[model samples]
Target: MRRGLKITLVAVTGAALTLSASACGGKKADSDDGGGGDKKSLKIGLAFDIGGRGDQSFNDSAAAGLDRAKKNLNVQTEEISAKPDEPDADKESRLRLMANKGYNPVIGVGFAYTTAIIKVAKDFPNTKFLVVDADQCKVEGANVSGACFSEEQGSYLVGAAAALKSKSGTIGFIGGVNVPLIQKFFAGYQAGAKAAKPGIKVLPPKYLTQPPNFNGFKDTGLGNEAAKGQLDQDADVIYHAAGGAGIGVIKTVGQAGKWAIGVDSDQYNQPAVAGVKQQILTSMVKHVDLAVYDFVESVANNTFKAGTKQYDLKNDGVGYAPSGGNVDDIKARLEELKAKIVSGEIQVPTKV
Candidate 1:
């Protein structure tokens, strides 16, 4: 189930419930409980991507960081989900709402919020802003920080795993959207597959949706259709970078007795796709959780740095998962490749 605390203006009782729930972490800035007078607590607000808090992938990773901050750092948090095809104005308003409500270090979870973060950060000089995935927000020395990742490097490892495990010698890639960001995943996968097997047939990738139509990230039917089409063409292994929709790809691949590579969080351990655990070979684990945690921790310590913070394989920020033991036999070989990539012996392309 997707779990989150909601705040609304019309529902006073609901808002009160949110505050009460938040109190579980710590006392809000406005609370007066007798033992202390208006105990101050760090307030964090996050704006999630289309899949929201529990899509079992990207958004869930960010939510995990927030949960950690609430427990380990005793901070209060509020998260809002984006609507399908929402306008940029909506995102700007969401960031403004959090800033106006005195929430410091407000975060925009996906690259979709890049423009909104840059625009909103200018108005609230006191508020710190973070945007994940898009490192191009060049507001040097400003209050905005971009938590960037080397997604292509991680995708390369999983692609090698897929090629190593495939029996049909043919593998495929399924992307959620046809944007440059998702394309990075395909590029790395293609390179890694070829590096592992010279004769391996990495079929042309399939993208479920293009820009302005991001339903591909959340639509299960599209995932199913894309995976089935690839399997029909004799592709025995498939990798998906489709957020919540990737669940559908895994389910279909498992039922067909083929292999499915997961993205973002470790899919082999995800409860939403637990029934198909054995079918998942490995996942391109992106440490979005670490990025969110570090950013919040910096604020709590009063040493927040503005600009871009990059996470890559060298820093243990991204790699392939070993869950389900599906990749145990070939892990040593994967490690060798990982070492080479980290040492600059191999250059994983960010573009296909």
Candidate 2:
């Protein structure tokens, strides 16, 4: 029940003819010939959530996938970004625009697009749409696919690393927004840390902002202030699920000579945080790139399935990055925990 039936031929071929006729000024007739000049070219459209490409986190991971598809598959691509507090209408408009411009398999890079994808997919029944981090769209139709991940599973591994490497026995978690999604990260981290070091002192989690105030995901100053507050309270090791804002957390930890765990992408290898590389103990690596690439590849091969595609620890979709060589000694123990989680021996919590 994961995927809907393949769309009928009339929807695909008729829609393509209509679009081509409108675009080509009736110069070319719609031919049913397969391959040769009759084969349709693939084009992908990406709608990034807040903290777009340069955030060095979530959006960057998706972009990496598109870049790979462009190189290996020789596909054309268009990318758009969401502004802070942008309304759902704006997202819908972006998707509509992409589909109108003949972009197939349009992707919305974050869960915020759940509403937009649900509304827009019905109008353009021929074009395929992919929404990352949101699975509700799967029930909408045969054209929408959701790419989700078990973030808690990855967070658990890094949390254990933080607990094991902490000298003060005190750790902190900084979340971008006080929402269920980010809470998953905190919940897993706390559970893992406690499991690694019993009775460890964990500071109360702090969020930069709540709903209607998404600046938490992009505000570097807020992240800096939050990390400094935690450090002042004797929390020597901190992990952040903020997007662009995490740069400040890493910087503050480095300047304070403490450890900081990264999320979404490997902050240790990111050039933006090169100066603070050593302080980044490790990052919960979420494979957004792999998911994006697979979706695009499926479209190229005419095997695009519309449903939920999950990335979890067992599938190598989410994992802890080996960075700075700081966690080399404890890698074996982390691997053991990973195996346990994959086998359901350890259940990581997704709620705070």
Candidate 3:
């Protein structure tokens, strides 16, 4: 699902410099030159999280936004993937390199980039920076923004779906990393499962790895091991917020004829997981693509705002996907819960 060249920082910088010398005598525009007369498309740089683009989950969703921007906005884009277990300095290098190359509105695709963005944004005061899943860029007058989502809301819906469709009373959750972000997914899932089936047994969330060891997001072996453990414990339905690792969970569950719930993108429709489509009960779809596209559009239209923007079910930003129609029987019920969450009647927990 992820197709593109990985532009190295040094190569991209030299190439961008050559292009800049020819374009506007090395002058960097604060925003896109609107109005169609000598309009210059914005240059965008996206740094991916641990699993990068081909994860078919989180990074792939962000890639969709870049794909749309390339097609509709005619913007130049460069994407770089993070090396597993890389330090924050490496992230800072990635962001600094992009800004130095005149790429405005550079974005970091995960919460891991919070420190990098804050450090790099201070140096490139004119370059706009956006971090997905983080809101720590509140330096006074800094040109940085955060695109956050109500992940708990979407997880809640999918949790209910799992409980309603589950033949067994036991359900399980697997988190890639034992961070607050993944915990949010577990918190909502447990709450929603209990809400739907008061007697449903939601096992303790299993984390593949702890922080600073984000291998959990990419290690399919770990995912498989975790899923098998849950299945052995009589978990008929399992949900995962494990990025690429979830691919293993889906396949393992499919082989065992149990149901698996996907995260970020709709695993039911992802070609990578096509073999297990039927077993995928549902997915908590977080609209990272919309957030990326909207952020780039804001810069292109010279309407860029440096602040945190929250996307929730109220704006169709985050919700559950019924790709395989496995959850169609309970879609109406899910929507009702969605409406109540939007109306503030149901307060989903963000922490377990």
Candidate 4:
């Protein structure tokens, strides 16, 4: 748990400054048309996780942000699909490639790139690096910004929804990793469920962490299996914090003739397994797209900042997904619970 302490640095111009690597120039980075700048072209590079694109979870959400960086920020962007074991290889290779090739700013997705970003950032001190969901990587280089989302805050609302909607007294949560971020989601959901139903029996399943496989994030089959186990135990609904793995939870719920919740983005509309198109009760959303796009824009304008920047329910960064599965009654209850939480009437559990 190496955390970089906040340091103050002077910019030589006698300007009192923070030691962090905050982008100084206000110049924006856009590359929409042909070649980025009237002066020079801007390029952006991305490294996807092991599940790559089809997982329909974290990687997909990150890709959506990268798409925004391309279209809105107008930066020529390239993505490298990372496999289970070699996820960081893409980050290392692409970071060096982009810096060496004169790319203004490069983006690395997921925690797998934490060490890679630090190593590459040192090699190319001139190029800027933005790492998403890497709050732990706080190296004091003059060119790095860390991005993360408050997943727990969003999970609380969905927990409330699940509790209210479950005809059975049982509901469950399956997580990809047992880290703070994912565990926080489970905790908040448990709190929400308790708040709504007073004594909701929620099953917490461990999809990863015991074995500690990097590919657990992409294990759709494993996710489904875990969710199925919960459903078989009579859980009416299941909430999933697995990345691409959540797709399996979605499938299990739909196929088993039960219900499930989604994370990151809206899973209700995405086409998954057989006939489970809309089985998702609702999704707990963390707007990683908005955060990633904002970082790209910031880097282009040369005003990116470091340190822990939190995106929570208040910032619209995290919340319950819209009820696309026609759970109007559940949505109403969720909204009510959301209001209560924000108003300090309820504290979503965020710890074991």
Scored by lDDT, the top model is 3
Give the residue spans of candidate 3 off by over 4 A. Answer: 1-38, 135-141
lDDT of 4 by residue, 1-352 (tens): 1111111222222212222333324444433443433423456666666676556777788878867665554456555556555544545765676577676677777776778888898888777887778845354466877777667678878888888888889998888876666778888888877878987898865655442366567877788778768888899898888888888778878787777888887877676643685677888877878877888787777677765466777778888777565567666677777777678786666686
Candidate 2 pairs with clashing backbones: none
The CA lDDT of each predicted structure is 0.85, 0.84, 0.86, 0.71
Local distance difference test, candidate 4: 0.71
Query: How does residue 252 of candidate 2 score in lDDT?
Result: 94
TM per candidate comes to: 0.91, 0.88, 0.90, 0.83
Model 3 Cα shift for residue 146 (angstroms): 0.3
Q: What is the lDDT of residue 328 in candidate 4?
A: 78
Better of 1 and 3 by lDDT: 3
Query: Please, what are the lDDT tens digits per residue for candidate 1 over residues 125-180?
Result: 99988898864434433898889889999999998888889999999999999888
Which has the higher lDDT value, candidate number 1 or candidate number 4?
A: 1
Displacement of residue 327 (Cα, Å) in model 4 is 3.3
Which residue pairs collide in model 4, if any? Answer: 8-19, 9-19, 27-301, 29-300, 31-74, 32-74
Candidate 1 ranges with C-alpha deviation above 4 Å? 1-39, 135-141
Worst 10 residues of 3 by lDDT: 14-23
How does model 2 fare in lDDT? 0.84
Mind sharing the TM-score for model 2?
0.88
